[model samples]
Target: MKPIVVTGGTGSLGRRVVRELLDAGREVVVLSRRARPVADGSRFVSVDLRTGDGLDQALTGVDTVVHCASTLTGGDEQAARTLIDAAKRAGVTHLVYISIVGIDRIPLPYYRTKLAVERQLEASGLGYTILRATQFHELVQHIFSLLGRSPIVPVPTMRFQPVDTRDVAGRLAELALGEPAGRVPDFGGPEVRDAKSLARAYLTATGRRRLLVPVRVPGRIMAGFRRGENLVGDRFDGEWTFEQFLAEHATRRPSRFTDAGGSGG
Candidate 1:
């Protein structure tokens, strides 16, 4: 069997997906723009998705491609287009993509680009599976950390169903192992929670005491969040809860916060 190529294999979710595939005893190739240390189970292939530099070569003889790479500085569409072209030339069997839930309802520019990428992937004629997930627990904690910079943290009057990245990785690995299924059921956390409560929980977990000021952020994005656009109440596909996630990361990030990404999931 040919190897599975994973774009952004060094990224937060991509790395986890690589681990899952490796544990499943599948050959994995981790593609990155620059060289990264790879002494583990997977092979590292340096390739650029934007300029198409080395992308075609790395994708050679690959059966599946799990596209986990995303751009915050823009050029996401270009990278996806470049990758699709390369995958077609390589005769890749399946292309799995990760997306966010309720991107269509939210009017954020980043969300718009994500939706556009989903459509582009669908029309690419490649066997593709799209997994739309909710906000990540790490990302939510990161937001609270930023808001908690001052003595009074302004908590948004919104709700979010944040899933664990580990769970998302497992789901993506399962989808990659299976045949193409377009836009599978949206994945979310076990509970749908308001931001204020989550913020308090985060503060307590991080051992910080700050006045949580519940502020109503007026905007289409906030309105969408308030309406739980970032949530999938019908089904909760994730196994880890926000509290469990916090427990694991309680020591990792005690003072500072790192963004999972600009967008959720």
Candidate 2:
């Protein structure tokens, strides 16, 4: 089996992909800005994509490149260019890109960058598969944390179909092993839940009591989320619900209570 190169292998999804690939008996090389040990017999190489530093060394002799590295604020195009050039130079057979669902519909800065990366991959002339997935379950937790403590969890009035990161990783590994097929079907969570409902579920599982207040933000990005722009196709397939995810982690900790008089804690 050819060695598979995984960018951002230290990240949540990237690490899972590396594990799946290695479990299938494929050689794995992790490319990141820092060297870190992984569990699946994968080797690590330090390469900063922002400065295009050490990319050549990472790409050398790599068979399939699964690009999981991305910037949320800026520099997406430059990073894509560097990775594509290095892959082409190294004669990489396939380039598998992991992207977010509904990037085109969302007006957020991160989503815009994701869309640009997708275009670059399509035009790169390398056999590629762009797998667009819905928000991960962990992402929702992060969002809730960022919102801070509040009596009422003010969720964006939108629908979400959050998938588990492991399922997305499995799909990416399978795509890497097969031929590139351009943009594949969108991968989404098993069920659709409103943002406020999901937040309430998180609170309940965590033993935190809070009211869910759905609000509409005055912006294109919020509008898109409200319209379910981040959702996958109607026919998309996956099996992981927010409830199941909450149940898995509910018993791990005690629930913290906060007053509704101020922001959530």
Candidate 3:
């Protein structure tokens, strides 16, 4: 069988997806801008998603692609277009994409770009699946660490559901292995928590103490978060909780967190 190519395979979520795919005994390829040593069972191919350099050659003989690659800056739609075109030429069957929840409700530029990419993939005429997941546990931890640096941590007066990357990875791996399912059910964390509460949890978990202050910024972006547009209500697919995640990690580092793809949420 042909390999399933995973973009941004070195990222936090991408790495786990690659591992999950490998564990399922599927041939895998890691496509990135730079050549890196991937897992033993998978091969890494250097390709620039921006300029489309080396993408065609790497995608040859590939039938499925898990697009964990993304950017907060501009150019995501262009990159997806390049990949879509290349996938079409390669005769790729399924293109699995990871996206964040609430892109439709959020007015953030990055979210708009993600939404655009989704539409692009849907129109690409290739079989595709899009998985929109809540923010990752590591990302939440990273946010807290940044805020907790000072004695008083002023967190945004908003709420979120933090899902574990492994859970999302396992689901993505399963999707990659199966037939394409367009826009499957949203994956979310076990509970919905406010940013202030999450900050407190981070302080408690990391053995740090800080005064939590909730700051309500006036903006559409903040409004979107406050409205819980980013959260998945009642339906939780993640098995792990935020508290469980903090217990497993002795130290939470920004390097361990990723905003790449929708996993950066």
The numbered model that scores best in lDDT is 3
lDDT of 2 by residue, 143-231 (tens): 77555366566777778888988889999999999998899998988878777667766776777766556677888888888888899
Model 3 — TM-score against the truth?
0.92
Indicate whether candidate 2 or candidate 3 has the larger TM-score. Answer: 3
TM-score for candidate 1 = 0.93
lDDT by residue for model 1 (157-245), tens: 88989999899999999999999999999999888888877876777688776766678999899999888888998988888888888
The TM-scores, one per candidate, come to 0.93, 0.91, 0.92
* lDDT to native, each model: 0.87, 0.82, 0.87
Off by over 4 Å in 2: 249-265
Clashing pairs in 1: none
